[model samples]
Target: MASSQPNMERFLREWRQDALNKAQYESAIFIGDKLLAMTNDDNDAFFLAQVHFAAGNYTRAQALLAKQDLLTSNPSCRYLAAHCLIKQNNFVEALAILGEHTPTHLFATNAKRKTTRGVRAATARANSKTSSRHHDQGDDIPEEDILNRRYEASMCYLRGLCYAKQNAFDRAKEAYKDALRIDVQCFEAFSQLVKNSLMSPDEEDEFMQSLAFNSIRAPGDDPDMEDEPADYVQMLYQTQLSKYHNPQAFNTAIESLSTHYGLENNADILLAKADLLYTQCRFKDALAITESILMDDKYNFAVYPIHLACLYELRKTNVLFLIAHELADTHPDEPCTWLAVGVYYFTTGKIADARRYFSKASMMDANFGPAWIGFAHTFAAEGEHDQAVTAYSTAARLFTGTHLPQVFLGMQNHAMNNMTAAEEFLKTAYSLCKTDPLLLNEMGIVLYHQDRLKEAVKMFASALKIAAETDSDPHAWLGARTNLGHALRRLRKYDEALEEFDQVLRDGGKDAQIFCAKGLIYLDKERPEEAVQVLHEALAIHPQDPIATELLNKALEESAEAGDIGLLGTADAAFGGETSEEGGMSGDLASFEQRLGEKKFAARMKLARGRRTAAEMPGQSGGVKDKGKGVARSGRRGAVGGTRLFRGDQEGVDSMELSD
Candidate 1:
């Protein structure tokens, strides 16, 4: 029956494989359980536990392991049981099983080692004091010293494990090396040392040899102990407490760990400290801790991601580049490192380089949203609007809830001079996120351009209200104010427009549009000179400005016309005084003769002249007139240079007629 068991196991394995391949997890678990019952072997039991674990039947797996008493016979079964207990948050029991059974397993061992080390240290110290008087005795001294030294070395190895678990690879490697210095034959310490050292330098052969030697020892040669130290419980409690976000709890954990184990040797405590600083937005301090880990040659690949994140948070882009370059050079197969490099490039405005790195990231993992977004932004920068839209659309489709792609799409259409389409996309974006002041402001600007003045005013007003209420952004408020001023100006509400422009100026808005609007108000008030001065000032700030140039010409022409009218008024006053000296007839006859002489000369020359000349020049009598009026008078008909200066209404005769 035992001989045929192998055949039965193979048949069951084939059946389970078929069930799994066919997406029949329930059938797979049923077959695996039967195999477990028939064989009661370590391999079959482990497989059965896996099927149950996969199928979310962790309770059944725990019961099966407990019934078989396979926890001792199989280290893997112990690990699986502990994993299930951890999932169930039976951490104390999980810690015990993990500490006792898998003393050198990376994940479970690291998880429990800090607590275990404290317990062992207290026990050793207690034993040492009890035997203190025999310390100087020859045989006993050496033996006791060796035991204490081994305990100390083991404690250091445990510290390394704690550090490794928290992603502090450098501190972990240091602790492991310290353990090895005290006890070179310490397999756990040597194993971690080899693992961490191989992370930076390619020493695969040496790492394999170290692993081979570490696993060669027997259970009896290094017997597992059960007397846990007091400090272990305290450290375990602190680790559990660190998961909460309470600052006081983190502080308590840090102080306790540092006081008991020393901060330099406590990598878990250091990681907790870094996390606390990160929560406080003290990214620089977090970056310093992460950088210390990367500098160590023994740092693990898992820690690289955390280190990258810390550098990114601090915006230490240059250092991130160097780290990424090193990671790419050594770990070319890993896509995350290359993806990080692409993100850095994209943020720094190196669009083409960003696209290349993003392409590399895409090749590694095509579904990476960030890489796709970076690729899209690069195309947008290069003015490939259609391609950019497609890339952003693809990224949005993959990650449905993100707003970044929609924002980019609106910006692209706005840049392409498609204002209507831009407004449509931005309205959808506003519906999705109404509190976004930027989207509101952009939509308002589009409406302003489309000449929907009332709608534009409402939009800008809404943006302003939201910005004020939320303290959203000062710049957004400034933009809305500027747009509001423009809309008011178009409506010819010059006073209200000036008030808005003044508000923007007070708000530190030195933009050219604000100045231009203020100039327009001056122009509307018939104060062209003032308008010219303001427009010129704007031009000085922004040379070759088109609006300023146009306004300046109108101002100069109006000034010239006003100057000519003042000169004509002075000429009339001088001629009036000279003609008043004679009697009314002589003055009028002389003026008429002067006007007639001037008219005959002008008619022969056919000269085009001012209205003043037409009114004052001599007419048919060929004499100057001093008619007691400024130039032409009541009941008088006069033509100068064949042009009639006075109509019948001006002549004061009922129907006076003039001849040329």
Candidate 2:
């Protein structure tokens, strides 16, 4: 039997391999059952349970393990059963099995510890217990004084784990300290003490000293045993150091781990250090570490994800392409890696490539929300507004609590000239996520477009307040201020509006929108010269901006008619010194004269000004009365079929003229 044991082991391993590779859950479970019947070994039964667990046949695994009575007889089997119970979230059952196991059984001990922590965490959650109060209690001493003191210390350690899982750091630290006082060599208590201390900066030095002492005392120690504890302590130090914007501590922790343990023994520690760098936006350092890992072992697939993330963060387009190509070759079946590749293409303006990769990701993971969103964004970039909206709506339906699809839908509706729909989507989004300054700003812009100037002002003001409160990016605050200026200008608060625009420009926001908005305010004030100068400046920034182009032309025509040759010359010089004599408007004042028809223009201007003032001062009955008389005059012009200026559709006037 001993001579045949090697062959039997090989056969069992091969069978396990074949079982693991089965595609269908039913097929895998059937194979697992056959293997269980063929073998009486506890390890073999555990492997069979693992197959059933992986195949989502948890009920079958539980029944099989129960029939074998392995949950009590074999520690490994008990650990596997506990894990399956955890997967099913049967925390009580899992904890029961875990409590019966001994910590000297490494695999079972780890599982038991994890399950016990989870059970305690679930209990705390169900009772709505606060962490501070729940974790502070010492071990419940029995009334019988005959209980062993070592048993009490073990209980204290278990309680410490309960507190650790609840994130009650202070109490967990005290519990671990109590355990240490009872038994100084309790590795579990020492490990928990290190973890809890690192979470609080005030206890970091003490934890470090404890760790140093333990590492020195353990002779011929299993490197794996120290690996997890050391790595955990290092992770805590890295986290706490990150709060202070220090990246060097992460490197130092990695160095210490490498010096104490061989490189192969600390692969996870290296990976964790790289992850910390990535979190700090140090993509270059992360990439370097990942590359080093890859060079040492080309088959290290775990490093690929980190490498992809680092490349994407650094905007290393060339490296991203290389990584994607390599990942596609090596990991063709993994949807998440493909999705990362697709996102890279999407962000870098390669919509077609993005669509292809997103399609592949969707094929791999049909329920992937990001792939669907990316597909919709690709269509949106192509100006296929209807298709984009449909795709976005589908994505939105598939995933709840995601604001991206809603935001994109709002943008699509806005682009389609559907103000009402756009405003509705934006408002819904705002209600869902009130803290999102971007949503608030979008809603304000939509309100402004609908001629709800007062509401628009309020919305923009709300966004600005939120931005200030949250310390949002300067660009976002600047955009809100710019929009607020336009809303204020529409309300005829000219001075206040100008102040907002000035602030935006002072903040280095030289976008054409700001320039055109300022120019429009000047034009409304009948300061055509200033309007011309401002509009010319706007065109210099963005010559093809429709608003700026139209406003500039209007300013030039008005200036030429007023015999302001200096202004005309300034405009001509601004436009590459092409004077009106060279087939420009100076030689064709007749066209301008014919368009203006001064009498009608002056009457329209006066009526427009009165209407604007009346709109701004809503409750001023006397001013409204005067504006009503002007409207009556404007109405007579309409009745006489003259130009019907100051129409109720003044907001649509620009569109109508542009169409003509």
The top-ranked prediction according to lDDT is 2
- Cα lDDT tens digits, model 2, 516-600, are 7677666555567898898888889998776677668877676675564454434334233332221222323324323443533
lDDT of each: 0.49, 0.51
Q: Native-vs-model 1 lDDT?
A: 0.49
Instruction: Please provide TM-scores, in order, for all candidate models, with all chains considered together.
Output: 0.40, 0.47
Candidate 1 per-residue C-alpha lDDT over 115-142 given as tens digits, one digit per residue, 9 for 90 to 100: 2112223325345433322111112345
- Which pairs clash inside model 2? none
Question: Per-residue error at 347 for model 2, in Å?
Answer: 4.9
lDDT of 1 at 179: 63
Cα deviation of 186, candidate 1, in Å:
40
